[model samples]
Target: MNPRALRAAGPAILLVAATLTVFAALAYGGAADPLATGDPGPFVRWGLPVAKLVVNLSAAVMVGSLVLALFALRAGEKEFDAALDVASIGAAVFTVSAGTVGFLTFLEAFNPQLSAGPEFGAQLGSFLTSVELGRTWLITTIAAAVVTILAFAIRSWTASLFTAILAIVSVIPMATQGHSGDLASHDATVTALSLHVVGAAAWLGGLVLLVVLRPVLTDRALPAVLARYSSIALVSFVVVTLSGFARTLSSIGAWDQLGTPYGGILAIKVAALVSMGLLGAWYRQRLIGRVATAARAARSFWTLIAVELGFMGIASGAAAALARTSPPFTETPYSTTPAEILTEEPLPPELTLDRWLTSWNVDLLWAFVAGFGIFFYVAAVVRLRRRGDRWPVYRTVFWVLGMLLLVWVTSGPINAYQEYLFSVHMLGHMLLTMAIPLLLVPGAPITLALRAIAKRDDGSRGGREWIMWAVHSPFARVVTHPLVAAAIFVGSLWVFYYTDLFRWSMYDHLGHVWMVTHFLLSGFLFVMSMIGIDPVPYRMPYPGRLVTLIAAAAIHAFFGVSLMMQSGLMMAEWFGAMGRTWGPTPLEDQYIGAGIAWSIGEIPTLITAITVAIQWSRSDERQQKRADRHADRTDDAELHAYNARLARIAERDAAGR
Candidate 1:
């Protein structure tokens, strides 16, 4: 490996070692107590513990495999490649060892006593016998190890073939080993656990692979690669986030458990992930500039990767703990039933003050209004496309109203309360940041304003000169540039959410309004910069636009995942003050809320990304075809001119004769 690659390896190794040590400590020190025969509870002698151990160990192995895949993708530096190979092998070995140890641990946890007595031993034996063949963690681990080794050793199509085989084998054991296989028993826990494990592996594993490969990527080719991965990441992020929430809800049984210790820890995990995501967005935005300039930003890039990986590790650790922790299915002193809260008597209408319009909701209305105005503006533009009519007052009114309405709506009471309502907040965020901006860009509001002003023609040379200067000013160029708008939209999201500013913004009506306003404006700027919804001052090349969209979406996905894994409600106190009764424990509600934020918020954004991709591709194709035709015409014209010149020279010689 080169010096840079070698330096990269150091961090990777350290990260791997730290992760293994943590998991090993948990395994050795965190083992549960052994129970005697005839234990009162329905604990599955060894089945549950064994299954858990297998899953955790398997996860470690998967992580190792991902590290290898990353190295393969980033094979630019030979030394780094060699180091990654070694690390990959080591990771594989660790996975096998961990799996072996976990299996033994499971056996010991479940069947410590060999006695075939009437009470516990008999029941345990019966349960074990009832389990299907090839259901043990031992089988799954061996299969995964074998496949991983083959994938490492082979080249060409065989590697992918083996990888597929391994993935399938991994699932079989997961299906059979857990309580989920006992379908007759209707075990929700096992089913939920199985889904959760699979989804997490896909999502986290993909992220690790992407991060590792990102460093060695060529600048010219990075956008396409990133775009492909962005799509994959989006799907994985959604699946993992939704499945995680489902698993949590099923395990916890009620919203009240959110206040419990386990729920609190889970919340922390979610928040950490969200924070990491915001960082990812920053990294993405920065990387775009670096890529465009062909500058080496390896150090900064690695730093961000390290941070992202660290958070992923934390989230994984929290998941492991959650698996071990007991859910609040049983009654507790602080329990506040879901039904009661959902059906609670409404507060007396007479005592109501101002209506509670959250920032998100207000933003939603603003988005709708802005959308309507843009639609009308577009209609007017299309109608006037055939005729160069002077600009109408009504059209100008529509444009100004649309802009003002969006700004004011995002800055009002609706924006303030959005954070309290997770789904609504996310909705507001999407509209303000993604949807509304799309509308604004197509309106060509700046171009329209300039045209309206210039039409007055006061006949003063100075006034016209000033208008021209303003139109061509540096400030105008900066705001109209795709890069600048992207910076504003993405930067605002990160700044608002990551700092104390986010917390402070959640506290009051005005703060909320300001936050929403910023979100909408930033979002509008970003979309306008990337896509020419309206006539931009200057448009980015199609390729550049594609990169911007893909990179921004990836950043957004990271943010959503982070939010989903937050450990505590960042705004729990704020919600409490708002008279929002989320049962006795706010943790579960918060988790659910984050899930809403991550999953629901992503749907519209992803759709937008897809649309952008399709449109960009079409535009590029058309431009290419047009260029080819123009080139052909120019060549023909040149040939004709050359022939005519030759004829003239020949005719002059004939006249002299």
Candidate 2:
């Protein structure tokens, strides 16, 4: 191999070897055991996890490279091309490894022989076509294959973005596969696993991309690229850490269980993760600035990166083993009630004021999002201040408050009882769509980000660049248009509840995520169109803004009134089926929800309208002040013209008389 290529490939090869060795040892010693009765032999037992390891690593490469490419690397550059090539290779490996896992899984479950018999072929066909698990793997394999081709072919920013998304989606099937025996809380487990896998991949893959691209990058460009990547890595680390903890908690309950083999492996993973985090912090704090300029520092940085890869390998390996490790909570196999069979959580205690405040189901996804959102925002503000830039304190406060409220709504009582109580669901909905955005929009986070983040002048893009692109893009302009925003805001209320979308959110975890995202976005757009301080493609005139607000409020109120007038319960099968003995009947709860929609929901809309009016008044005052300034500059030319016209009319009238 050539010297430069060898240098780039060596670290990754060693890292993979280290990961596989550690993973296989852990899997064999701690968790992996061939099924005693329907044994699929050592091949299936060992091959599955190794396959999974390949899947994980490949996914990281595919996702991380695409993300880094989109965010940091410039198109038509050698570094960008190298990243895409790595992504394509990763996708190819992902495709093959995923298919192998599917085959191994089929062997493990059905113990099918390799004979060319018709019955065997039919059984295989049924497994691939009829079974959900088999279908999942099949789809994932196919998607990976597609991504492989696309990653090789596409190099543009938008295409790479889509490729990244496709790579992330390919892992979802794997996320849904693990811990399947626990049917009741499968949603939580699935959500946690999905987040964990995605986060870990991005974290691992981005670092690997940096290592691979070291040769291609120039000394001048490396630090800025690293800086951009550091943000993504930081966010990825937060997500992984939080999701891993949540997944572990769901499996291992008591503190004493930490002594078990499963817990030992988990501890090892945690230690490795902590070590990597510290290493990352050291890099950011000490080495990130100097690596680009100082020769000795650059060498030290590469050495540190190699060590960090070692730690990442350990973590990744242990994670694979831990998936195979049987949890203590699942060991006892205690009898479960029907509710436990259905919901995966025990029926929550009676809802009370105190319970509403204190209860926690721990939706780690949203919780971490909130936590990181607050942290990064505060960090950005602090960064600005340290550099002698001024940022409004109120924006920070509003953002923090909004995020805290989001956490409460997602992880607290509203989340706990939303499935059982329509009123609580509506309350959460209102908060997500109205109250949260009310605060968040006024916070003007996009503005803060634009101001606080440094502008990237190189061919590459960073957070500030992306944020600017998003705000000014054709899609953004279309969506953020006052009319479009208002239509979406008012239209969602009817479409969400009156259709199957509400029920889908109730039953499906992914659907629930979509619901939250949709509402949050719609609300943000609407609020931004009204009184947002951030720059947009276009905003309506102040009177038009007020008019939009009034129209949206009226439509929103009418939606609530329509709900209040409903004769029957919405999603009776899902919400009504949750057997709750404590609170209102399903119909009465629906009525309460309608009331919340009609009365409480309008409070924010009213506040928004009032805010719009105040903004309108201030806008007019600003216009008048601008006119005065113009008059001062031009010696009142408009007034002089008016006077001339008046004099001419008076002269004409006098002559006629």
Candidate 3:
């Protein structure tokens, strides 16, 4: 097919393919089978998935177009505007589809009579307001509507970026409903499904972007833009692949279960993904460079893009069906104990020396963050080395160590038991706020990034541009300021533990994410203000640094001591109620956690004070060396001039006497 025709037909092909596949899969899986009681009819059954398919496709285009506009296309240009226009249109569709899905879901779930009567309206309103599933879809619909307006109104870089983030977030509620896996797999499933959805959006949407905007992709610009898009697609593919694996593991109980209806749909999706990945990584990748100069390669690449779109349609359709299909079994055994009832997870084996080293429950989000963190850092170092620009070996080591430690803190024993064990939670907090920052600050990641990443001459802002903007942005200046950083660092420790923030973090996933981010960023900023090599707006003298550290440490110690002195358990309903036959009693564990905060936390402060002193000494020695060098170069002209002025004044005074 001609490129123009193919581009126009891409969405149609995907829609038709998805439509065909979803009903067939639904039939085979018995998801659309008649209910034994309170059946909402076939229209409700069929319309929901169709609406969801549109939501998935439209979400992809909206988010993908915005992301591609940021990374791949130049700003203030036709192609860039076109991308935003595409996103706006996609968001509009997403809003409508999501709203339809929400409404249809209500009908399917509640079997409310389709009517405009007050009674029917009241029932629908209660469902939308009172039910979790209803609320999730409602929020998704409203978020999509907001994204629609933002995407239409915003063309500037920052606005478009924020709009893109909102678009991504809008799909999260739907992704959360991806699998009905065990509660044991809740965090992992949620994280993985969210990533898979977002990544697949970018990958599929970028291709749609290329086809739909073919007129603007000039020969000279096409190669570079395609190359950039390819890079984004590659990263997306990796994320999708990994996250899909995690979701799959949670869904399929055993190898034998792969023959089940859910498994059949999963297998089809997997095949589509693998095929798409190969096409993207191999054929399309090779053709992107040649497409500018070679006409045959251009045609071949566009054809391959069409093929990938079909595969995406298959994957998207399969995914929607799989979400509705019942899995073979679940990992959540029936929980009877209070600990299990409250936490939605079984009580881990009693906290012990061996478990700290051995226990693991992977949090995919942070693992991916750390994994990519290490990969890119190493790549930057290699890029510098190849260019004969040397980065310190110790910096690289510290960076890797920091990332490794981050992975462990997030996904290791600390994460597994932090919810159940107060001492473990406090230990993780101290490490996150103090020790990890100590290791990470020395890495000088910002310095390395500025040196390693090439500057973009084009109108588009790449990684370097974004980094510089963020550092110099007003928010950074305020947060990085010494007094502000110190205040937040100290204030948050008190504010978090004493306020409902602690309870929120324990109960809500979003709250937990916010808690971790707040501490890590606050810690990093405080440490950076003190000893980090990265450029900041301001820094105090060495003595002042020491004083600040001392004051913060004193407050920290006081906080710890106060916690230890508390007679009652914090969040007593939670910490006190978990029916654990484990190590220490609740009160004793709280004391142990407070002890960790007081003693172990103070060690990092001591280390920082020592580091400051050593840095001060080294700075002074370097100043003296510079002074001696100046003396050797110019016979101490500055010193001689000062002395001569003093002598002249004395002689004049004597003459006057």
Candidate 4:
């Protein structure tokens, strides 16, 4: 083998050997018991060892192949490209084989009653029959694993093809699983299982790819690659979160079950995920470019990646265990009573306007509609005109509606939930901190407003003056400043959540409304300040933008961790009333909620930071070049003018002589 191949094979070999050793111990240690119990007979007994071997061997091969591919990215490694191709193909094959074998083995283990006899289908008819369901889960998992592996093995076109296929195949199984579907359906268990499998695969697979390939990529390519990968990771993270929430709600049945064993495990899992995400954010924002620049101690980047991978492993293990265990309180003969259960919910046939409509659902609906309208209108206006103009009536209406809708949504939800209030405050936090900001940042309302004012009839004397003044106003510049916006956005989340203000805000509707409004506004200002979706009143330099992102991310990290460490509920009475149970104890539930805040919350925020940083850097570079060219032209003009003056002076002197 070539040097690169040998180096790549070392890690792969070690990983394979380690996995094999582990599996061997697991298989032999318990193989006889399952066979003796008749829960699994000779078929499973025989299949288990073979399946274990295949899974370990294939994993090694896949890792090895990925390592080899990394070699192709190194400078002066043309020969390595050929080797990479071979390894990639080998990896793809082995990954597929492992998935297949594992699936079959899982089937055998979970569905030992399957017989070659005519009554096979009848025997496996019960959808909830633990054995058959386990087998199906294994099959789906292997399928997802195969597709995810293949997605990274091929060229761009082929990779995209495989990715799309993987997404479709993976989502079908997920939807079929209980978590994504009706909780009361027969497939609920399957849905939950499928989601866990797919979510874990997507997250773990992407991390593995990044860790293995990152070291070899060139500097110029690293940022762009990171940007692309970050986008994918963001999408995956969101899916994982959404799916997890759905599964938790479905499995636990009621909020009070959070105090149970299953709930505790789920909370731990959430914390682990959040920690991993924070680490990922750190790597992307702090270490990524440093690694590319070959800064000293760059190996730290690799170490962090490994740490991330380890956390992912823990989470996966926890998930595997959770799947095997029954949910707490659920196994009891009597179900826990829900605090409030809406019956026969009605849908509105026609839209109605009400000034006193303070319902959470109503606010959320209006916010959704208004947010969409504002974004659409603003985008349209920008596309229509190259130069900035005044805010149009349509745009104005949309902005007002969107902002009002947001205010209503944030306030109403907190108010409604405050009655049961434990973490309803956190829900308020989420709306203010995450959802509202996301909607508003992209809308670029301020920029649109300024543009609209500028578009007024030139003949109107007062209109022109107002437009120019607003555009040039000190208030506009200061408020829209990147630093100022980021501070408010990041600071508000941390301060409100950490202090009595968070609790105090929940007591009354208006207080809650004020808090929510502030949060949404702060988030909007912050995101818009950092990212130039619509024109800002004033643009910060690239370095400033980077600093803003970094500082804000740091603050967010602190917020999450602080919340995770809190000993008591921020809003106890409301939470108790809402039937929001963390696990078995208030503290545990708080920890879990904190974990959710700390970990899952960081994923999107970090992604946004990285995106803004890269965009700003690229834009800054382009702008600098333009400035240089302009400066050169000015210099040339001055030189030409001087030469002309000198010539005239000489001609006059000669004429006088």
Scored by TM-score, the top model is 3
For model 1, where is the 10-residue window of minimal lDDT? 343-352
Residue 104 in candidate 2 has what lDDT? 83
CA-RMSD of model 3: 1.4
Worst 10-residue lDDT window, candidate 3: 176-185
lDDT of each: 0.52, 0.83, 0.88, 0.52
Candidate 2, residue 219: lDDT? 82
Query: In terms of TM-score, how similar is model 3 to the real structure?
Result: 0.98
Q: Give stretches of model 4 more than 4 Å off.
A: 1-38, 41-168, 178-202, 253-259, 329-657
Candidate 4 global Cα RMSD: 19.9
**Model 2 lowest lDDT segment of ten:** 331-340
Going through the candidates in the order shown, the clash numbers are: 29, 2, 0, 31
lDDT-wise, the better of 2 and 3 is 3
Instruction: Give residue 435's lDDT in candidate 4 (0 to 100).
Output: 56
**Model 1 backbone overlap count:** 29
Q: CA shift at 561, candidate 4, in angstroms?
A: 60
Ranked by lDDT from best down, the candidates are 3, 2, 4, 1
Off by over 4 Å in 1: 1-91, 94-98, 111-134, 168-172, 175-195, 210-227, 285-298, 330-657
TM-score of each: 0.40, 0.93, 0.98, 0.41
Cα-lDDT of candidate 4: 0.52
